[model samples]
Target: MFAIVFILLLFSTGDSILIGKIQNSTIIDVTHISLFNITLNQCICKLITVSGIIPAANYFPGNQSCQLFNFNNNSSLISSNFNTYWIFTNQSSAFITNTSITSTSSPTTSISSSSTTTSTTTSSTTSLSTTSTSTTTSSSTTTTTGCTNLGMFPYQSTYSVGVSPQSVAVVDVNSDNKPDIIVANFGSNTVGVLLNVGNGTFLSQTNYSVGSAPESVAVVDVNSDNKPDIIVANTLSTNVGVLLNTGNGIFRNQTTYAVGTQPWSVTVSDVNNDNKPDIIVANFGSNTVSVLLNAGNGTFLTQTTYTVGTSPMSVAVVDVNSDNKPDIIVANSLSNNVGVLLNTGSGTFLGQVTYITGTNPKSVGIVDVNNDTKPDIIVANYANTISVLLNRGNGTFLNATTYLIGLSPLSVAVVDVNSDNYPDITVANSLSNAVGVLLNT
Candidate 1:
């Protein structure tokens, strides 16, 4: 008796995909013991068994499944002969009767010959399991190795109030190119303004109370005065507080506007096509996204209130559906999904697409992860882990791969810290009281 084995292997990568197969052409005649020259094809390699004496005019048949092994050094999956079999015969009458062969041995073979030529080669190969494992290991190692050992263990400090600061925005306010950080103290009624000293360190200048609670902040040229102004959401107050940057690392006289009940997050953008920037607040308590038009100066006029999902915490602007116009992306905290608001480009809401990430996604940053021109989303999940939603660039997002970093990642900031064009993610974890910075090695 004789047996044959065949195997097929398939894999892919971010840039390229591939598929291939290995087939056994000849079955070894082990009854009388014969050996024959097996013509190897460029794609198929004949595997032979060990401890078997080779006889002339015989071909070895693979008795087991061919294992297609992918080598890391080689760009393609390489197949080797390592399977084996055993043959036996029964002597009955005048001569020996035909006997069945069983695969009792593993096919362990020495290197006889190899087909090094390839018909077609792709620029990349995707071994998703290996790739995923490698990626996960590399990320874990990077998290443990690359972070700046600020060396100072974070000791509990008495903030202005016993509130957990969730978000931090750094913007150059004084025209000095040095960014000033404004921390949104979510648990407390106060917001801390840390003035950047241009040396990576910040000075605690002032901590001011906005409303009942402050959640998010954005610095923009709100009045077209060539100066950046601050817009913060007074969440509990159900309004937005506008603070004008005084050009001296200080903000004075915060103006308030009644927008909605329990506004969770606020962003400044040119939403109404008015050339002047407008304020879009995600009112979580009301399940609406409020659009406040800039009134030429530091004040705003109510434009429209569009309904969204529950607990809309973060809002982002992008050309999501590739309609050439900017669209809105809102991260709903309670719903665990990011709502996509298709911009009608005429100051009206057109449609929406809901996508979920990790648990409690509070903040989102758009960055091109796969060298694609389109931007991908990096979600900072508060309840669970971090996730990277790669943009397929076809009005759809690839399933997010959760990257474990730290406890309760509330904020994420991306920049080319190593001068590479690729952006590195640095997350500010609230509960751990440490920054989890991930460097793309």
Candidate 2:
């Protein structure tokens, strides 16, 4: 009977492969994703194949209800819960039943065949373990299984990444629809560049060696030549390096100029209010931020140096404390604060605001974490937690929520993982070896 159910489900999608389904939250392994269909609204979907079987259809009933279904080997219908009870059914018998419990439930089911189908679910902001599935079969035998969820009240879930990654700056030097990743390795002396392979996966193209170390990297048309250029802050080098992107990944005419001691971060902004992008370098070795006026050519002239706080590691240009012009926010790593530099609208700094944050900060990124119109600050700290600072738009940060994440997070990159119109965080944990992803609710 299980063999028949497996064959039917596998044949339903016109694929001859085994498929598996998750009842409630229980995960089963399938060999392929070709056998099941997935349908969901507002909830994220994840598909895993096990033992040569694919996953069954995933249906999101609504914001408050979710059901994972699959047919068992005995042609029984299986159901798992989002809020209440759990039950497993074969065409003729009940295998497992937990009626007294009242919580979200999950079950797993599987079958064997050949061929494949693909489907996806919407991403949520809740925490869920990563699911894996695989399937295997022999020439003479077949197997089928089912999982079910039976529950009461179901609510939409919010998913968070394991480590919050922010500070993603995309640029296509090759005119590809995809963007390349220029990561500023703060502690490491190299800048990691990952090329987009048109597909969803990113390939590490090359790592450029910069002096001392790099904190942040920005790509822009510095010469108005239509091609992008790379700007990196050599923290210990106490200078900024410009590498003009040469159609290929190789950079030429590498130029280095003094800005300040321990230049920790850099940003390209139109400081003169003339629409021409300018350069701002935050110095950590020195308590100052340097502004360089763009010469229209590929070179820059030092404009002025403004004193900031202690150990500024990150810089951002935003119109906070709005006065029609953009302001500068520097994440002071050692000071445990973010320094806001109010713009004078005339290429000068007027005043500054200091917002207290968590300890031993490494990097910072801005996003609308609470769905508010104003941007919030997500700080990745070496202290092992992420600090979410709500921007008041008046140069002040409201109460911050620090989320405990991976160990020794060095940087952050924010992107939409499931295309939910909301942003998620990805963290590059230096010591952890693997990148951690956090989905925002």
Candidate 3:
């Protein structure tokens, strides 16, 4: 019984050459192979095993078998009843194969000789059977290593609230160190409180009845009692509701104070520098921001209305010019811009300076996004984007960078949710019926 083995080396022109072969050798090592020629073409080497004789005559046939073997510098010869042949090529031919021939006691061998006469070369060849295997291993390693730096921010969880949660405020309502959430549920005509139970989770929400169609809620220590109270903007009732914190996650009956028509949002700050917290309301129907001076005992003086852009939907207080006086920033939904009302150290506001933003900007939040020590403005535009305006530190803002958010983003809040020290954004997506959290990179 005779078995035939065939080995084929195919390459593009000038890529590879068959230098020579060593025949009838008992032991073969890396030192026994030599390169005789060189080529300029880039080489690609592949080793494929074909069983039985092939149709081409270039491969040796009849009782000759080729087996895959690796040649290393420290390899030792294994005793076998076979003959070994080694072939060497140039540097471009990095792949090699070894053939073991089994024959009768005496075997006749023939050698085909060809002379180039142009150059003579001498270099050792090492069988690279594992070269292709190592290359594939490296490719797989690179693919997995590249994914480590692509940080992804996925939703942690969503806690269901009342119908149509239009606004949200994060505070410690029960004096717990963990931050709690208060939502103005417009459709339910109530304020919902979700106590934080730690680890980015919330307990079942508790609701308190307020005036009709509560659009916004703010937590503040209104009575100087060291306990945070809840203030709500009742849109349909055209009033502001003040709920005194009665301790232990409970609130007293809401005290309604009449403000401009269709009050949409409320913020608590010391607008007059009287060391007492005052309430500011954004009136959507009247196109004004109403300031209610705190009377120091859970009561507010008569509301004073200031003219702003059309349909003032949200309000924020900050020292826009670094003058130590709190200035007001309003997001005008109908005007498609933000109105900056600089405070004059008294209770009066200067004429409004408007900075254009995305269409139908609904809510605004202030944060130092660029680490420049000046607060920037982030607005949630109902036109399906979030606008970011960098502050120039002198009560004015530059052009906006708009990012596509969830459908119908009605409100936005900035907080560092991932502990990365950078501010992340949370938007109340009214149309999508979900809260969208965008983690800062």
Candidate 4:
């Protein structure tokens, strides 16, 4: 009697050539393997034992059914194989096997392979179980090497929001520990809040009317009530609207505060260090930024307007001069440059220091890109490039270095996505409908 023994192997990143691909060919055999109800490792191990050939397959846990399409030798999932994974909306997944048994010995030879698949809820680690059957050789199993079998989609769900949402903010409006989605619907002139009900699903959106053509939205705990409130930049109405969260994701009627003409963006921060959040708006039409100081109870004490370059589309509040005082960084759309307004003290900003950027600069982002402890500036220019200006610690910036990304970059964001400790850049290219990422080495 011949006993089949499976030997598992591990491949490193350099051994990618050994991985297999499913070839497109005429179907030769259609086999359904559903009898083995076991772990993913044992399932694929047994699968190769029976078929001796890899095939295109689909598996679902809902019915515990798996269909394998076998074409031929050339029809093998790959020229000759590792493991291939296919992801679906189904809870379970299917695999395309690519292992070749070069030669088979008689009764005592080990004939097995190990595969690791990851699931959303749980990840099972596989160990190489090399069962030796030779009488001269003592039977041994390597039980310590764990392979991460990854099958993840914790929240592979999607929900519908309103049409033409210009901007969004995520906050725990209902204090559920789950962040909910809030959007400014530019088309409908309303701010929509979709409360999270845990596990990636959100309740129906509740919309509150703001000003006409609301372009941006920000969330902060206004009125010191410890609840997240909503602030929207209504461009057509040339004002900022505040909607107080009346508990449980509900908001009261909006209270409007007049600002510069065509307010395109808004930000919330304690610019004055008063322990209260203030509202800042970028008025595109007037080439000005409005700073509304927070009076007691989330109310504003009128806005103080600051002169910047023409067509200031976006504004960022950060200490550009390393003085610990929050300054203002504005991306001037018409002037094709970025201007830094250093805060003198107590929310008073001095004249702007201009730094040239690419044509039609649209947005500003502050990041310490070079690990220099000083915050750097990133500008998104509509002329198909993004400009980086290194800060010189004292208000001024070095020359701009432009990186060609794609068509019409309208917004820029900086983050350390790959854990390399170096900051990376993400740009939203409006002309291409795709986002471009620039990773730092």
What are the models' TM-scores? 0.56, 0.58, 0.58, 0.71
1 or 4, greater by TM-score: 4
> lDDT per residue, candidate 3, 98-144, as tens digits?
53333323323332243222211112222321111100000111111
Worst 10 residues of 2 by lDDT: 1-10
Please write out the lDDT profile of model 2 over residues 1-441, one tens digit for every residue.
011001122223333222333333322322222223323321122222233222343333321222233333422222234443322222222233322223222333433333232223321121222233332322322122332222222344332211222234578765676777766666556666667788656675466666666666788878776777888887778788887777765566457778989887789988778766788988888878888878778788864888777877788887766577877877888888777788888888875677777787778887776666677778888888788888886667897788878888888867777668788888878887868888888
Candidate 1, residue 441: the lDDT equals 60
lDDT of each: 0.61, 0.61, 0.70, 0.71
- TM accuracy, model 3: 0.58
Write candidate 4's Cα lDDT for 37-127 as tens digits. 2334433333344434443443333222233444343222222112324222211223344333332222212223322221211111112
Top candidate (lDDT): 4
lDDT of 4: 0.71
Task: List, in order, the clash count of every candidate structure.
Answer: 11, 75, 0, 13
lDDT of 3: 0.70
